[model samples]
Target: MKILQITPFFFPSIGGIENYVYNLSTNLSNKEHKITILTVNTENVQKEEIISEKVSVYRCSLNFRYHKGLISIEFIKRILSANDYDIYHVHIPFPLGLEIAVVASKIHKIPLVVTHHGEYTKGNVFFSLISSIYSKICRNISLKYVDWILFLTSSYSVSLRLNKKIRKKIKIIKTGVDIQRFSATNDGAILRKKYGFTANDKIVLFVGSLSIYNRYKGVDYLIRALHEIRSVNNSVKLLIVGEGKLVSELKELAKELKLEKEVIFATSVSDEELPYCYAMCDVFALPSISGPESFGIVLLEAMASGKPVIASGLPGVNDVVKDGITGYLVEPKNVKQLSQRILKIIKDVKLGKKFGRNSQRVIIEEYQWANIVEEFEELYNNAMCKNGDGGT
Candidate 1:
């Protein structure tokens, strides 16, 4: 199958949607499916680069930005000109991309599959009102035309409250993790020593972009919770892995809380070292405070690393982190509860290990990339059949 994946961001831009598109495209390419990624040139990298015999990337010139979305007229033009794809699978929250895909599907009579990552929920009052109105218009039109809509979890699909016709088009497909790369066997000793973290220190890991646009991630809440945890347990350390515009602000917050020594900021971590970062943590936390965080992919990565995890009890996130089995789930932005959950795992070694074991088991049984790719393949075939094209 020749698949064109349209997204707002890709490699060099670290985020959940970017990582999802990268993994999905690469995995499909490995199965001998031709995959072409169409994304904005946010980082001004190569315009067009072939990743493998079956995989390639084409970065469209970015025109500008409107709030959180990147606007690229070049991207829309490219989509209009292209007609050779067997599948047009676009990831959204990208309103322009979805609109163009709807147009392209009509023009070429091709199957269009949309993966709705989440809604836009990070803006002020006026912007939020505008975003809501624009989202409703775009979603109604796109849902009517798209061949299928993939969601990260059934709970998220239910949250949308789509009518019966739209619900029929929904398929629940969770984001996947590279289980082999993020296993328990990967040693974190080098990373620990590099960060001056002694064996006695219990590391609480948080990985995500620290951009102001991503304030919904609730990193400030996590920092405050760490401050609380530190009062009783001086050995507890917060290791934040990722870099963005809000890095300085987060650093200032840590300093203000007198946690300069307790908080370790790893800003220059490479892709190859991410697994080690996960391996070094005693507990992983993602305290996202809003709807934009539909699903937390980092939670899965940490779980695959055989680490106990704690995340907001948001609809999609709760589906990923089982409240009592794989890890605990606290209310979004609850600093006290977040601290208590982290302390529970850190203080009780046996419970933490049990959660870690369950975490690995869940990853092996459900969230492996190979298994996820197979699900996609099946969905693609079904989409083609529905479009009266049979199979590729």
Candidate 2:
């Protein structure tokens, strides 16, 4: 099938959506399907670049952007007039681009598929409210023309609050991770030794950006929880990976909480070394407080590394980590609950090991990239089969 993936950003950009489009396109390309990514040239990316034998990318410049979304009437006209694609798959939440994609798909009569990557809202209340209203209007119009809509989680679909007309088009397909690189045997000892962590020290890992915009990742709450966790187990150490605007503030927070020694921040790690960061940890925690985190891909990465997870009991997370089985889920931003859950997994070695094993099994069986690609392929086929038949 010839697939055209329309997204706001592409390779070289560090974001969940960017990674998703790259991985999915490359995987499908490798499987003998033609895949082309059309994204904004925000970072001066090549106008045309070959990612693989079957995959290529084309970038267009944006005239203006609000938050992470782009607005370019010329780019839309160019995309709409393009005639090479067999199917049009749009990754949405960017209201402006999305509206254009919808109109283009209808004009071209291309089977349209929409992937909702959570609510792409940002900025303060007044701006956020305006954006929300605009996004909803675009979404409703787009849904009326889309052949199908893919959602990462059921909770995310619920969050959309779409009516029956649009809701029936929803299909839940999770984003996936590479399993081999994230295997349990990926040695973290070298990294642990470099970080001055003793073999006996229990490492709790948190991976993701610390940008002020992403404060909802709940890194602050995790820092607060560390005080309670250390009271019972001083050997426990917190390893925060990634960098952002909030890095200095977070560092100051650790110092103010007197957790300087207990918390070690590794500002950055390369893609190849990220698995080791996960493998080195006894448990992985993500305390996201917002609905934007539709699916915590980091949780799967840690699970693939054979580590137990303790994350916010958000709807999306609950779908990935089974409470008390693969890992424990605590209420979002509840420091006391978060701390207690962390202790539950850390204090008991055997239980922790069991959870880790369960996590690996779950990831391998359900969250591998290979399996996820097949699911997408099936969806593509279904969309094609329905083409010209007025199927939704």
Candidate 3:
């Protein structure tokens, strides 16, 4: 089927939502289904959108508040009107995504499927109120001919707070990665050794776009957990692999806690280097708080890298990591519990390896992009099955 994915940013930009579109669309493209992305016309992206035998990217050069293409409603209309896609699938909650999809559904008489992939319901009061307005608007537009809402986790499914009737339209589909591209390896032997990390020192990695809003990615919790963790084992080192506004502050706190030498803030690491970073880790950590993280993509990557992980026991992360099996899940923002779990993995080498292997097994079974896209393709066919008529 021909699928058109609408989002603000695409490849070259780093984000979970962007990864969802890239990996799923590319996987579908490889399967001989036509896939195209409608995104922002950032200065760096010269082509409006890429078109190939199986995949196409259409970039609209319109600026909005935050690269959301919020300023160019007509541009979105043009993109939607120009394409004769079998299904219009949107991957975000922005005005552009909902607006363009709504218009396209009306003009083209296609079914509209929205994938709510974030924790939109847990933001601050102002955002919560604004999101309420947008959610209502989205629900109204969706209810007209909505076929399905693909939520990344049941937690997010509940977070959307859609009416029970509308909730029936929700389906739980975990975000996926290219498992073939990521596999269990030991980047530590060469990569870590060269990077001044000794085999003796435990390396914990965190990857994501850090912002002021998500400082409690539980990175701070990791730092706080350090006081307890390092009391006995001081060989633990942290590799924070992302850049954001909180970089400078985090650096200072590391110094204040005397962990400056123990923590490495690594941003701008290339894609080729990412797997190695994960492979080098003795264990991986994704300590995101409830609502701060909708789905932990890094957890799967860690599993694929054959590294045991410890994530916050929030809905999305817990849904992925099975405690004492694939990985352990502790309470959100609980530094003590997080520290204790970290100590467990570090202390018991056998249990650590067991968790890592189990993680690999589970991720291979459920988190691979090849398997995940089929679920999406099915949803798309259902969405497009509905014509332009407001017939539900």
TM-scores of all models? 0.98, 0.95, 0.91
Instruction: Tell how far residue 297 is off in model 3, in angstroms.
Output: 1.0
What digit string (tens of lDDT, one per residue) describes model 3 on residues 1-392?
A: 77778776677667787788887787888778888787766445665556567888877766555322255654566656745767777776656567667777777777777777664434567666766676677654564456677778886567555677777777888777766667885444777765678878988778887766565586888877876788878998888898778788888888998898788888678887788888888778888875747787878888988889998887666788888898788888888898888888888989989998998998888887778877776666666555533221
lDDT: the better of candidates 1 and 3: 1
List runs of model 2 lying over 4 Å from the truth.
45-47, 389-392
> Candidate 1: deviation at residue 254, Å?
0.9
- The prediction achieving the highest TM-score against the true structure is 1
lDDT of 1: 0.90
Between candidates 2 and 3, name the one with more favorable TM-score. 2
Ranking by lDDT: 1, 2, 3
Q: lDDT (CA) for every model shown?
A: 0.90, 0.84, 0.75
RMSD of each: 1.1, 2.1, 3.0
Model 1: ten consecutive residues of lowest lDDT: 133-142
Question: Where in model 1 is the C-alpha error above 4 Å?
Answer: none
Lowest-sum lDDT 10-residue window in model 2: 383-392
